[model samples]
Target: MTTVQATFDSVDPATGEVVGTHPIAGPEEVQAAVDRARPAADWWASLGFAGRAERLGRWKAALTRRAHELADVVHAETGKPHADAMLEIILAIDHTAWAAKHARKVLGPHRRSPGLLMANHAATVEYQPLGVVGVIGPWNYPVFTPMGSIAYALAAGNAVVFKPSEYTPAVGRWLADSFAEVVPEQPVFQVVTGLGATGAALCASGVAKIAFTGSPGTGKKIMAACAETLTPVLIEAGGKDALLVDADADIDAAADAAVWGGFSNAGQTCVGVERVYVHERVYDEFVAKVVEKAREVKPGTQIGPITMPAQLDIIRRHIDDAVARGGKALTGGTVGARFVEPTVLVDVPEDAAAVREETFGPTLTVAKVRDMDEAIAKANDTTYGLGGTVFSKSRGMELARRLRSGMVAVNSVISFAGVPSLPFGGSGDSGFGRIHGPEGLREFGRPKAIARQRFRAPLVLTTFARTAKVDERVEKLIKLLHGR
Candidate 1:
């Protein structure tokens, strides 16, 4: 028997030792995988909506039953708290179930509009499935991020070829295995493990569409590559999201949300609160409350280690730059071996890298704005528009709508992520296309429009034998209906 050797080591951040090893798939292996997937995809797509939904339900049951085990794998690889891992799993399962239950309603046949000129024709539109979809997932929120694309695509009747981040290949393999157990008759979903090269190979492969979740820099590169083949893509890139606190906002509640949003999962969240804008009237009070909350939260005790050790340097540099540029740190401002101290800064300069760039760590910068309008301007200045929160007693909804983003929460943070009915995605530099709700179901399917002529037209304008008198009468009728 031939055995594949592990190409990379999976290190436990809490410790420094290797927990497990994952096989690295080369270019040839990737091509072979895609080749094998073609027929399987056809077979899976042939199973109509009901058949696919039944298989998806079985897969959901398996995942729900083994949720803890999968969460453990996530914790081992990402160094997030077990509770945080469980939350991700629960959201992933919820999205999977929603995708299966809502696919038909979202993609089923529907009557389309017939123009006044084509009143004798009947028109209809239906969503057709894409062939095979390629999903390149991220390490942070491994379960939630990938499933946003995978489950939606699968439920839309497309096979998925997943390339999980190298750091968490085990979790990806676990997901694929569970799915296989539910749909053993067809290789409907598969996993190919490796690093950047593996991901590039998947992109170059002839998949119908590619869904990539990662940094903006990497997302740009993926988009450029996909353009070569004219293949459609959906990107869920990183964010420098903000939380604006109005003058009448509850300081304690805003402070609590800031702490959780900025430090949870060690601030590895894409929608984490990296920047904050506060009204000058209550800025001092809000700062005090935030500092109090920051003091209560500490690394390795309240939060876990930085899953990616290299991120520690970026976090430290952002803090240093903020302080060097006249910003003040009211709390922790240091980096440890595997963790970053919970840090909060006030009066950070707008142009500083800490404010301009994305620092995916447990650090936040707060600024005092004159009023809500200024708060909205500063919040919209960033290139990212993923997710944001607004904390205001009266202006919550109005402020939430003013921010240019895909999802916004009123008086709360990240609540939109929990709502299964809302679409989850972003606009502007954050990327386009959706991966949740009805939009997500249609994302994996193509719109097919059908038109049939039901009866002969009274004027018979389509035929070449139409006389000038008939054309003049038709023009007069159009002008009469639309106004001269």
Candidate 2:
């Protein structure tokens, strides 16, 4: 007798329609995937940076050519607008290309200064692949967010076993299938579908590194599980990111950014602007403009449904709690079964859940501050430090520096994520380990340092045969070079 595999449905949040069915992968299946990855990683790494890049280029080309097809999968699974899905796919494609093209320059062997004391030695450092990498992706921005890790890991010469969020497994499968179309030799990239248990299995699969994107609570759990095996992990957890408006900021631009940053993607973005601090001088004007812009954003048209069904209750609770605590809604404040209207709340207490917690919905809590000092203080008060925005002509960079997030956009919103060269991650409760750019390419690899003796040292200090005279001369040389 044969046993049937357990399966689950991926539902479209907007219409509750069954998008696809996927098998639930257990620990055994997850381990098998990692086991297969070991040899594939060796082959992929042996290809050298140039050879691997050639194949990665083909993979990216395949992704770009059929981007619309992938976008449809993203939209169907996540309930995001078709255009938004396409935008995510486009960004992912660009990052994949960037990683493949720049991997050699970023991770290839490079010379290091031998220093005065080691002048006779040649020193060098290079990054080597950590074998197999496990990527646990989030549902929101499924394509773009996970690619931050997936592309960089593959480009760095590591095989990957990706476990896409249960809600968006099809998108993950689509990506792996597309990759197979280009590089079908050895399962360089593959996907396993399931719920939390599958993710835990991946974490404990003994992969070289695990890159995860999810909630802080879940991030802690992932960390704990990975710790059991001493597996290194990269986490891009959710954030309560903020947008600050200075007294001299462009009110119109700030408002537009606030609306888009806070409401776009139904505010399911980990770096989405959930809070705003406006200077008292322009608080009313800024709120008014934000309200005007937000009103034009219609739910089910401009914004999509909350991808996760449970998020609707959280959105409702945040709104109700704010109103109960004397806050006022400037515009939209209602939550439907599947969608939530853009809600702007003012006068909410700083300690309220809406202010302190990650709402993860299309809602914004706008507060007035006396000056930029207060704005900075309030913005940095949260435990989550992922991303933020500052709108000021003169103080853009200065204020951005003060915010406690990993990446900040000045005079814009979420711009850092679009730039391929910027590293993205967070600190404190938002989690750590970057995943984009040079830092990201290195995150999936280990550094190998080499020091070769070019010739015998005249004053041999490292040998037991060194004489006192040589030691004294070395001390004098050190003092001559660094004592000042």
The candidate maximizing TM-score is 2
Candidate 2 lowest-lDDT run of ten: 457-466
| Colliding residue pairs in candidate 1 | none
Give a tens-digit lDDT track for model 2, residues 35-141. 99999999999999999999999988888889898989998998889999999899998999999999989999999999988999999999999999999999999
Model 2 residue 189 distance off true place after TM-score fit, in angstroms: 0.3
Candidate number achieving the greatest lDDT relative to the actual structure = 2
Evaluate residue 446 in candidate 1 and report its C-alpha lDDT on the 0 to 100 scale. 92
For 1-484, candidate 1 gives per-residue lDDT tens digits of 9976549877778787787888888878877888878888888888878988989999899999999999999988888888889999999999999999988888989988888888889999989899899999999898998999999999999989999998888889999999998889878889999988898888889899999999887888888888899989999888889999999998889989998999898889988899999999999998898888888887776788888777888898899998998999989888888988789998899999888888999998999999999999999998888999999999899999999999898788898998777898897778889888999889899999998999988888878999999999899989988985
TM-score of each: 0.97, 0.99
Residue 168 accuracy (lDDT) in model 1: 87
